[model samples]
Target: MRQHLWMICASLALVTASSAMADNFGMAGCGLGSMVLQSNGKEQIFVGTTNGTSASQTFGITSGTSNCKDDAATVAAMYISVNQEALKRDIARGNGESISGLASILNCSDSDALGTSLQRNFGGIFQNTISDSKEVAVQIRQSVYSDTTLASSCKAI
Candidate 1:
């Protein structure tokens, strides 16, 4: 159908744009939805719904495909980069879904503690005009390592 083709083309265009700028994935995480919907903002809700409905996110995570397979650092960085807007809001508040998700990925035992730590060092982790996810990830890791309790608590960071 023409509508389907247009949607696919639009999705690809979004993916290309986001990938070129930040090498970021969709808010749906890793899955078919992520592949088809790479833009941020409200479109993320659609992406998440698609992934959830299709169960591709589970498959991708289990099978290590669709951007699910990567080193801890790389995955963490990609997550941080893709969820910058959420992270920005949550980090300012010192607790939210983004922080919780990051804690899970980084294998931290205490999501609240991690969120607090990130909130405490918000300025440093989110420094001026950081376009690179890897850079932001490194800063986050460094922030975690700087805190003695958090360093010991987060096994993957």
Candidate 2:
């Protein structure tokens, strides 16, 4: 009787684990790190298995939380934080590759328009000591909500 109950419990655990994994494929290092799982929701850290977290850490650029920022949508948030100085320089330079790269990372549609908008709004959007990826992400996501065609073409990250 105990053996049968154990089998049933293991089966349920497998099913629950598989279900949680299905939620985010792109988030799993674009494809490779699927076997490993990460969830702060789980109290035990997947029964002390660090396989998934290690794989995620190995693939730094792919992990959304790679940058170690407080709040980030994905690795892109980390990129934004890391590149703040470069972005500031690019915005100051006016309509160029760095601005375009910034636009691409932020998921904006029009490179020129985003460059122009960031150039125009640099003073307000960026700050001296703040990385501001979360703040900028809020603005971009809000663009999807309130305004979609404001030349910047902000989209949800």
lDDT of 2 by residue, 50-107 (tens): 3354664445434544322222256455666666677667766657776677567656
TM-score of 2: 0.50
RMSD of each: 13.3, 6.7
TM-scores of the candidates in the order shown? 0.56, 0.50
Top of the candidates by lDDT: 1
The clash count for each model shown is 0, 3
Error of 1 at 135 (Å): 1.9
TM-score, cand. 1: 0.56
> All models: lDDT?
0.82, 0.52
Query: Which predicted model would earn the best TM-score?
Result: 1
Where is model 1 more than 4 Å wrong at Cα?
1-62, 65-69, 129-131
**Span of ten consecutive residues with least summed lDDT in model 2:** 25-34
